[model samples]
Target: MEHDGQLELYTAVADQLKEAHARVRASQVPEGVRMALTRKLLVITAAAKHDLADAARRLESFMKDLDEGRIPEEDH
Candidate 1:
């Protein structure tokens, strides 16, 4: 349900997409708006995943640097 301390945004968005797709498939009339919205949602989720990956890499690098005493502490 949560990741990276406490975050379920990505998971919730994915779950919402699945539910929306089911509705769109069952509707007889053209749900152009729904389809478009779903597409946007897909793009956003994909972007989020990509961004998260980048963040993880940065976090790992930061942690490693800190462990090696190479990371400079913020000026207080």
Candidate 2:
């Protein structure tokens, strides 16, 4: 059913979010950069409440950036 599919998607996103958090924490980036990344993740978490699919897409893009070494510069 559609409900079941949504539940699965939610579960998968939740798991991915956890892994993403761990990755950010384990990353060697500077503290400011890590904090910014954390803020982005938090925004994605909040967005999931209203638009889960969009949140998942955002999270995926975020993870891809991390994996590809595309870290943002730390703000002064």
Name the best candidate (by lDDT).
Answer: 2
lDDT digits (tens) for residues 1-76 of candidate 1: 3464335544544565565456545545335644654454455456656775443444444335434644332322
Each model's lDDT: 0.48, 0.94
**lDDT of candidate 1 vs native?**
0.48
RMSD of each: 18.1, 0.6
Number of the predicted model whose TM-score against the real structure is largest: 2
Error of 2 at 10 (Å): 0.3
| TM-score for candidate 2 | 0.96
| lDDT (Cα, tens digit) per residue for candidate 2, span 1-76 | 9999999999989999999999999999889999999999999999999999999999999999999999888856
In order of listing, the candidates' clash counts read: 0, 0
**Candidate 1, backbone clash total:** 0
